[model samples]
Target: MKNISMKNVVMGSVLAIAAVTSLSANATPVCSGTVAGNGASFSAGTNFVKVAFTPKCSANVFLDGEETSPTVFRVGSASLKGKTKFGGSSVGGSVGNMGACTGAGGVCSGTDSAAAMTAASS
Candidate 1:
């Protein structure tokens, strides 16, 4: 009887662990293209880390073209690849070490060129 009880406990523990691991992977986080812009940033506070994103072109984008970004931001670095969807397209993401953010900039640069090309192509 003791042997059977021990086995049950061990099996329960294993199942619990597997369940937790599965949930962790699925809970990574997700965001829509609500918040898009140049020099946009988010911080997990000191507890997690500070994350920032910069644009290389004219980027003053808004979520759904509204006027703000999403409330929850899931940033990824080169070492920690992430995902993002914007401008009716899904794009990959990358974030670096947590520190003073010197992200990209282009609120009025290549972005203009991109828009022009897009218009011409259309």
Candidate 2:
């Protein structure tokens, strides 16, 4: 009975390790994209690593950091600008990251609008 229990423990440990390894291997945060009826689209990375907006609109996407400069990604018709929340860490995250949009030349407003903007926040 003792030997059997030891074998069971070893098998359980191995299986647990394999499960963890497989999960980690496939663990990737997903990015987000938004498309408007006017043929505009917006996309941003999960960890604030990348941001893309459509129709050649200029945008700045970033994670909140004291010494880091906000990186700009130029998008097209629909522009997307995002800042990770005060305590948040991801770009497209709901709780921590905030996204705002505006139209070219300040015509449109909100994410639903077909505008572009640059966002900077502390």
- Global lDDT of each model? 0.22, 0.24
What tens-digit string does per-residue lDDT give for candidate 1 at 1-122? 65344323322322332222211111122122123223223333332223322221111221111111222222211101111111211111221122211224322222322232222212
Task: Return the TM-score for candidate 1, rounded to 2 decimals.
Answer: 0.19
Off by over 4 Å in 1: 22-122
TM-score of each: 0.19, 0.18
- In terms of lDDT, the poorest run of 10 residues in model 2 is 22-31
lDDT of 2 at 94: 18
- What is the TM-score (0 to 1) of candidate 2? 0.18
lDDT of 2 by residue, 39-61 (tens): 12334444222434332112221
Error of 2 at 54 (Å): 42
* lDDT, model 2, position 55: 27
